[model samples]
Target chain A: MIDKEQVHRVAHLARLELQPEEETQFEGQLNSILEYFEQLSELNTEDVAPTTRAIDVSNITRIDQLKSSPNREEILDCAPEREGDFFRVPKIMGEG
Target chain B: MVSIRDLHQQLINKDRSAIEIAQEALQRTKELEPKLRSFLRLTEEHALAQAKQVDAKISAGEDIGLLAGIPIGIKDNMCTQGIPTTCGSKILENFIPPFESTVTGRLAESGAVMVGKTNLDEFAMGSSTENSAYQVTANPWDLDRVPGGSSGGSAAAVAGGQCVVSLGSDTGGSIRQPAGLCGVVGLKPTYGLVSRYGLVAYASSLDQIGPFSRSVEDTAILLGAIAGYDPQDSTSLKVDVPDYTQYLKPDLKGVKVGVITETFGEGLDDEVKGVVETAIAQLKELGAEIQEISCPRFRYGLPTYYIIAPSEASANLARYDGVKYGFRKPDSNNLINMYTQTRAEGFGAEVKRRIMIGTYALSAGYYDAYYLKAQKVRTLIKQDFEAAFESVDVLVCPTSPTTAFKAGEKTDDPLSMYLSDLMTIPVNLAGLPGLSLPCGFDQKGLPIGLQIIGNVLREDQVLHTAYAYEQATQWHEKQPSL
Candidate 1:
């Protein structure tokens, strides 16, 4: 079973803040789910290549071209906290 | 629900004005919304105005195409300019997208009226619509039961006769599972066949947007309107788009249909299995040859999807960090605190759980063991499908192990909820096309779906086979008494 400490660390890395109750609840749920995944390990996968795309075509490119864009004011209007023309946020690179 | 062709004929004959049709649709929605809760936001004014525009065009003797004046639901994840595209999550609850998704944009151009945005699981994460942060959409067949999700609302809307047709995205059976449960025709076109430019990504590599309709013919009509190469979507295929309706052969003569053995055994409901087997037999009577085939590695699809989908979701959803758009914390001293608090307050439990799983799988020293291994298994599963398809033109299976369950039955157990898509996930993994249509009903009268799966880009064959079987059965005529 995955331990509580490991759950906390994974949640932190995912940028989520789990409540105490949620942390404990997830500890059990994630463990069982993880255990189910162990069934896949029984197969030998030597010399097999990973498939990122099912149909193999990749690196598709289009010529560089200019196109009309959404209005900037409308785009910034959805921001929760915004300055005159910029999205507002708490200061970074310094301790609170 | 009436077919799109009938609606078009009605409009052309001036039997009903577009405005009249739109009002009737809204009226029907109001009468049923309390029971189904299919829509998150109803675009009454927008729908009426668009209908009026179609009416004006027809009055001027202009061609407005097949979808003209038809009211339909757009799954909330697909963007609609000025409409709130929440993805059924608190994080995007207030996000009024400034642009239209390619699918909806094409539909609008075809003169289809947008009646509203349908509900879905938060970020399309869960198997049931109960995961929606706003409201749980109920199956029209039985109010106590779920409309299978994350496209549950879309499926429910069509099944409830709220709309002629609707759009839904399928990544690991989001569209097909719900379609199976709700007793509607749902199609997931080959990956990259329909552009994913405006779909809010759960798993970019797996997601494909398609339609839900009461008839397979309508499914073809709607799919044709939105499919084609899009410069905006880098992965959009450059292949020729055919009039899929022409491929609707009434008989599947000399067609080779494979019945997947792995999907039938263990944990599947006896009634569902019986219904699927009978449906396969019906296909044989329709002049198709049926073969029982084995894809030995097929059972691993569920685990592979769990890893690959979440890993991609973690990266795609990372953009919502309480910044440019979406919900944010009101009180936080620093940026780090704000990010954490906003995400904590905004995301639902299932979304958070997936993010954590993805993070764990992709973390340092574990990437090779989980995420990479899942991808390699994905390769094996794809090869298994390729090997099976060599002898069969198409494969058929049960869309879900059981019919729609009670709303809260599987909510407590995520793994059980994941099983609802077990038979459909491998199709997504292989990036193939699949169609789910009503085949029969369980003892309680809930709908059972028969899935017809085709090789990559072979949707035409899949549709033709489904059409033949559909013509031979009366299942599609059964509607929930809402």
Candidate 2:
């Protein structure tokens, strides 16, 4: 069974900061779900190929062409923080 | 609610103007909104405007489509230009999509009026609409019970006669489960049968857009309008769109129906089972050759879906990092902190739990044992369907194990909630077309659903069978008195 440390690690990887109570709640929840998933091991699929999609349509490509979007202003307007035409982000470079 | 064909007839025959119909729909929606809480945002002005356009065409002796001026609800997961397309999440609370999803685009082209955006489980994650950050949509049948979700609002809208028809996205039983609970007809068209372009992705492989209506004919009409090839979605099938209504014959003569034995076993509610069994008997009466087919790997759908859907969701939802559109938590000094805090603050508990589960499954050392293993089992599940279809034209089962449960019934126990989609998930996993139509009602007067699953791209067979059963039964004619 996974503990709080492992839950925290997974939460961090998913880019989610869990509250103390949420971490504890998820620990029990995840372990129960994972335990249910253990039933899959009963089937021997050594030679089985994994199915990624219901339909197998492969290598779908379109002609490379430049087409300007008509809603550029509307798209940029959806950003939470924008600087003129670009989206603004928090600092990436840390202080030395 | 009237059928789309009848509404179109009313418009063309000048018995009722499109504006009048739209107003009536909107008025009904307004009246029911307090009790049902189905819609997130109603586009009353836009719907009336679209209806006026259809009215103009009729006055000028111009041809109009079947869906012309029919008020419809859209699950907010699909992008709607200039509309707040929240996936029922706080993250996208203010995100107005600048574009239209292919399905909605097609519906607009067919002259369907956009009445509103419906609520859903946040990011289409939960079985019950309780996960919606906005509101928990109540079942129209029983105001205290949950309209099964994440397409609860869409199903409720259609079933409650708030709209003639509505669209929903099903990753795993999102459309069908709610359709069952709300006593509406819902279809999850074959994956790739309906284009996924502009749908807010939850699980890329599993997510599909479908219709919810009060009758099989309306479902077929809406499916015909939306099902086709599109260059925008690469996964869309490059196939001809058939007139799905042509297959809706009143007889299921010589049709092979398979009763999935695995679905009948443990945990299924006795009332639901009895109702489904009666529906199956009705199918036999319609000249269908019924046989019991065992898909041994069927029950594994829950675990397999939990892994695959979340794993893909983890990747698809990564785009929500504070850099792009959507809610971004402020006051973060660093980029990483911005992302973590944004997600933590924006997402609900269920969404966060899924993200964590997916992260762990796809993370280092667990990929082979979890995600890869689930995918392999998914193949076995597919093969089981393929084998069954070799002998049967369609498979039959209960759409949901039980009818609509009271809200907050399974909220605390996520596993119990996951069991709600047990029978329906395998259909999504196999990429098959599945539909749920009202079969009967339980002791509590809540509706039970009969699921009809078809082979890949064989929606014709599924619709035909459902049409036959629907014609014979009076279940679809009953609506809840609000």
Candidate 3:
């Protein structure tokens, strides 16, 4: 049913650290969910192309034009953190 | 007491100033906010200013849009320039957008006044508005029960009489489910009928910006204003945007309405089934032909939807890193921590859960097994509609399994929450249009929504069927006791 290793792997992939409290609950939940998904394994889709979009569209493009977008200041105004013209965030690479 | 048609008359006769109507709506919002919590942010100043501008235009004999002064609640997912487009998530609590979405921009251009941004599930991922990081929008009818989400606030706003209409995004029944729960008219147009330029993506292929209103006519009026081909949304179809309002009063004679026999079976509340069956009988009396249609693939709608929707959600939500817009974390030594901590702290539980599931589904070995497989199953579900529509003009079912439950009733149970949209998700998967209309009430007096499903571009039939049903029933006439 619920695979602890899969749950751990999923947590790692999603970048979420599951506390002990959540792990027990998630183990059962994720397994039940996977069991539901296993139902789809029965469907015959050897010839079907995956329907990525609901409607069919071909050559959906617009003329490339350099239209003036919101200025940099206006764009960055909504950012939670900023430095000069760029958005400032935690130094994601090296220790400061 | 006034439909949009009559309201237009009152406006034309100068019996009501746009400012007067707007102030009335704002006053109602103030009165209802304590109980309903329908709005995340109310744009009273902006709304009144827009109303005065409309009055000025009318006085100057300048042509005004049909909905020029009507106050409408916009679900928070649709970005409004200079307004916080939170999408009911804490991560974007202070994240105001610099640009308005195409749908909102279209409505603004067409003279629809924005009352405020309404609440929704975090990223429109849940059925109950309880998942909203900010607040839960109470159904105007009961005040204790939920207004179905992620468009709960929009539906509650319309149902509560705070606004004449509202805009909502439907991803796996967000619009229709809330509309059903709230006892109002909600339409999720064919996936590409309305542009998705500014509406925050939950499940890209399934998401659509639609209308929530008190009447079918109001829904049509609003849909007409917003529906059009937009080059901004690559997925938006270039197909002709029909004058949807023209189909408001279509001939119902010979209209083939199909009843999904399975939707009335187990899992549906007895009261809801009774209401849907009664609505069908009334539709049959309205000179429309009724037939029993079976869609077997609908049984797997949930599993297929979960896989495909989350897979897309995983890819779509990748933009919200600490480096870009919205919330960012503090100094971190590495990129992985930056991504993980920022997302973990910023996103709410439901969003994190979905992201986790999506990431897992798209991961290396699981990609073909989960995500790719789901897409294949999605086609079979779509084909089910293709075959069923051949014999029917529109498929009919209960919009939800039941009326709105108490707000906290299903919040802890994610599976129960997922099942809330069981009936509505298939239509989205098939890329067909569906509408939820007030058909009847339960024994507890809670409103029930009868769903009308139509083949691709058969919105005309859907609206007309709903209109005929509304015309024959007095259910929609009853409002909240407040």
TM-scores of chain A, one for each prediction: 0.87, 0.93, 0.77
Model 2 stretches with alpha carbons more than 4 Å out:
A94-96
Q: What TM-score, computed on C-alpha atoms, does each candidate reach?
A: 0.99, 0.99, 0.97
Off by over 4 Å in 3: none
In candidate 1, what are the lDDT values of residues A1-96, reduced to their tens digit? 689999999988988989999999999999988998998898788789999988766788867889777577889899998899989988886476
Local error of candidate 3 at residue B22 (angstroms):
0.7
DockQ of 2: 0.76
lDDT of 1 by residue, B1-482 (tens): 68899889999999989999999999999899999999999999999999999999999999879999999999999999898999999999889998889999999999999999999999999889898999999999999999999999999999999988999999999999999999999999999899999899999999999999999999999999999899889889888999999999999889999999999899899999999999999999999998999999989999999999999999898999999999998878888888889999999999998998898899998899899999999999999999999999999999999999998999899999998899999999999999999999998999999999999899899999989989999999999997
Cα lDDT tens digits, model 2, B321-434, are 877699999989888889999999999988888888899999999999999999999999999999999999999999999899999889999999999999999999999999
lDDT of 1: 0.93
Q: Which is the better candidate, 2 or 3, if ranked by TM-score?
A: 2
**Error at A2, model 2, angstroms:** 1.3
| C-alpha positional error of residue B90 in candidate 3 after TM-score superposition, expressed in Å | 0.7
